[model samples]
Target chain A: MKKFLGAELFFESLYDLGIRTIFGLPGGYVLKIYDVMPSYSKKINHVLTRHEQAATHMADGFSRASGLPGIILCTSGPAATNTITGITTAYSDSVPVLVFTGQVPTPFLGSDAFQEADHIGITRSCTKHNTLVRKTVDLPKAIAEALFISNTGKKGPVLVDMPKDVLISESEYKMPKEVKIKSYSPKVPLKNSEYESFRKVLTASKRPLLIFGKGACSDFNKKLISKFLNKSKLPAMSSIMSLGLIDGTNKFNFGVVGEGGSAVSEDLINKADLIVSVGCDLIKIVPESNLKSKDIVVVNIDKANFNARTKGNMNIHTDSDNFIEKLSAEKGLSFEWEADNLQKLREKYLNSQEKEAKTNKRAGIFKLISNLSPKNSVFCSDFSYEDVILQKFLSVSDFKDSILSGGNGTPGYGFPAAIGATFARPKSKVISISSGINFQFNMQELIVTLEQKIDLTIVVLNEKKNKQKKYSGPDYKSLGESFGVKSHQLSYNDKNFENNFKKFFNHKGTALIEILI
Target chain B: MRHIISILVDNEPGVLARIAGLFTARGFNIESLCVAETEKPSLSRLTLVTSGDEWIIDQIVKRFENMINVIKVEDLSGEDSLERELIIARISTNQKTRSEVLRVADIFRANVVDVGPKSYALELTGNKEKLEAFIEILRPLGLKEISRTGLISLKREKKKITER
Candidate 1:
């Protein structure tokens, strides 16, 4: 076997794993990896982000958009700490992200050397798994294992802390043929008995409901799930994190089922006799008061997720994709759900929403944006009053079509995530919606969007005289101009609103539209 | 309601702290814990005692299995298993009570490890109930400083016996 430096193996492993792009900021300890960047520059494209946090958010967005483990690289100490919020965000949402942080030399690990931090200890609770590589030979195995742990089962962030000396040390390079952890198994085999039980309950119910949670929020599973729901004619609802699993036009599809969910959807959840929650924990799905009387079946890849809140009549230990495929393949499995009452309820709810939009300026602006969006456009929302408003009116055609910060609810996740979505789906229009105050959290990333020349449109809702006084300041148009991005300010109710909005929305490159309500 | 969870994990630095951190993060308390190297030197066995309902115990076991370094986890609660605890206690004694303490120790099969002018140090090993009984008997005899090696356990082997 030929000998290679740890840094060489690091980049080689990433290249072999099909990672074309990475986001990070170079610092003292991580200079070794950057030093070797020139040799393999063609294979890997590194985006030098303004801050480690933005880099992590970009990776998270990239992962959610591309369905691949997002990769983030940074140095030790403060740089590593900067990525905590982003890492926690990925952890909460169960997004698969590979985080590599450079550490001080192994000898200086415990001495509190400059730029040194105990990455493993600090990230233990937030990450699915983490390792501190002490030997150069262990680098390849660690990288492969971290990727595996992050992208499989209950997908979450995984961190690999690399000491400077180990990165520079030479070792015989042998690609690990197969990486397996004796204890970590992401897939639980589907047992025939459990499947039969699920089928029996699914087929026998008068009113059955299907709920899609983050566990079922995957690109590959979307078509299979939609086909299953349509064929069975089963009423379906989604959690906010998985808004787009069932197309908005699907007659059986109900909007969200959690906080800020529609009243009609909540009523449907209460009326349904049998609820097969795929990849959802069912928290808040069934009201605590009605939990005992509720009959639920939960299908999840990880048994740990099936806790007291998720305890059901039957728990199937299988992933969403596998469960959907198996359920769809079995012939003669049909649900006798009545769609007439559900249709009437949905129509009523939608009409009420339309009436509200006529009076509520925020709702009206969101409705206009939702109507004007092109087919297959991706919308990333930051945490604000507008985030919930957008979910209420926006129609999602596919999985990941509407990317909200599901788990961590991190502020300022919209813009960088949109940038990441643009890279992941270059052919599709990527739009970010945020309030004026929340957009300022990571507004500095506008320069990155301009530099990359990514095709993205950002809409910042500048609601004046807001109920929350502190969150009602800042001129986003001026800030966008400072970053050299095309900026426009317009009112949602302007006479030529449609024309002005389309001008920026259809722009070929990055644009920021500040909608004053 | 009490559970004894035995886990086998890779022996490495910070492994213990990680386990403790998991319990603390979930707002669960570890009542008593014992850890030491097993026959396989690279792996360590950790036995922790806790009390909760069945659901809480199930959650704890699942959470441990979710951890990467943990090799195996078995809840020995209500299982066919053997449990042992070791306790060393020093009891304040006088000439009138010294012999009485020794007599009680002899009954409990405990050894008088040290005999000082003011106190008698007794070493005992038994199941939880037996250890508790011994401590109760010694408390009135003026029990002083005490140290205990918390509960350690292993599953019992299933072996059949032939008639002699």
Candidate 2:
């Protein structure tokens, strides 16, 4: 008889799914599961966050960096409620994540027992799928189903609420051979005809521009995009999510292009006759583009269904990579419009950007680090204007990674996500940048960095008093020292600040850089 | 303009709260709402009456369609549809007004369900306008308490069942 405790089987399932790290907080109802986690610690790392919400943010950052569903575990009541912001952020941005919450005993449900909260009810609207486990026998199956729903199709968050008694209960366990949700079947390897038509329209246009979004950030899409750009020789720009999925320094690359995008990108959008949309500008942002409905070609995963905003526009529903792969397969396309302005525009934008960065050193902290850094890696920031400054100054790279919370507009996400991003790629340098005020939201998570002792740099931007509000806060440098992490502070007036920045970078382990503006 | 939107959703717990809470949380007004199980055992149809401009109504319908467990949302206010509401009122009755009330009820084809010594319980099923008119005529008879099953509607055009 293959019998195991339900809680033990839960780890077996997650480990089998290739989940390396589980960001979580311990609680009474979750103690049964935590008891077994130490046995598997060598195989899986548990990053105990100061707050459950930060745990989810770390998972979100990990998912964005690795293109895998990040797992977050929490206890009942407040533990579960705290995760709502992260879950909604994932849902809004289409990042895949799995959330497991411990619930009060099954019998006590609806009776308002100790630490009881309706996890499924509260998160139903925000999540793509969720379930409350009743029978212990259903635990493994429910876990499998939650992962399946979150990882497939238009990816989003899925939650599973596990009762404490159910974790204690036993059943003959069999690892599910396969998991399936009957209603969801994401279209794959789109029909060749759809690709053929899209290719013809794209090839014929003299003034064509390609724009990619988060949907094109998957590993497979990265390969397809490089090949597509190489063959077609078309200039391109990234929508906020697609940053770092394309080479920012590439001559054809325009910076991110919407709402918070640059003037050059906007001008390119206005001048182009044909705008190719690879899963972006669909519902909300189209109002700003002002592009005629006829000029847009939306390529998505709908299997021939029209996009929300581009109802009458030409939309080819297919896997973005598969479609682009086939389009690029045909002997590579290059247009001759008598000294095409595409390459010229790229150089024009690059020159102006350099001039701007040189003039704006106040904005130059982000610019200098991005441009002069020896190694390229992941970047994470919050929903503040500081993010607008970062995106504007930083150059994106396809080989690197960047994680933005994507309009969740919540402040606490950047730093924790950077920690998780570093864990995703431990050897590489991960920069978690944020303004001073926003950085305090979850600065407590810095302890995890100390426990793990990884190479992570957290840069906090602080503004000095100009006879305005005083900088009445704790010394962040001293704060890092208290956590047993190296810290440095730099402001404009410091004559040796530049030299200290170099030494800080040379220092190993976890480091914090506070730059006063 | 007023709009009546019909939504079909999975008959599950907490789904009603999600829908009603969305309206209340967003401060969208709901004039009336009627919900019941549809012909299918697993599904429930909710009819909600609201008033707003074209843009507000569009946003509400689109957002409702995006909710989990919501299978379909149809705006029946714009199309040619049949609308009905049931209103039950307890009116103070006396010797002078009893026959008069019955005559008024007869004109509207309303039914007198119960007759207490001093009050008569009247039930009327019609469009909102007809019910409002009847309420006005019954005011002199001393209308007391009323319960209304808000507007529910369906398009007159013949159609096959939509896939869930």
TM-score of chain B of each: 0.93, 0.94
Per TM-score, the best of the predicted structures is 1
Across residues A1-517, which tens digit of lDDT does each residue of candidate 1 receive? Answer: 7888888888998998789999999999888899999998999988888988889999988887778889999999999999999999999889999999999999888898998888989998899888898999988888889999999888999999999999999998766889887667777778889888877776777787888888988767788777777777777888877878878877777777755676576678778887778888675445655445667788887777675754457788887888887877767665555568778877876777778778877667767777888888888887554466556667778766777686677999888888888878888888888888778888889999988888899999887674664435778888899889999999876899878887777787889999987
lDDT of each: 0.83, 0.78
Worst ten-residue run, lDDT, model 2 chain A?
A: A302-311
Candidate 1's residue-wise lDDT over B1-164, tens digit each? Answer: 89999988888887788788877876888889999998878888999998877886787788787787888888888889899999999999999999999999999999999988999999999999999999999999999988999999988886211111
Candidate 1 docking DockQ: 0.45
Per model, how much of the real contact set is kept?
0.64, 0.07
Off by over 4 Å in 1: A309-312, A333-336, A384-386, A466-472, B92-98, B114-120, B158-164
Candidate 2, residue A155: lDDT? 81
lDDT of 2: 0.78
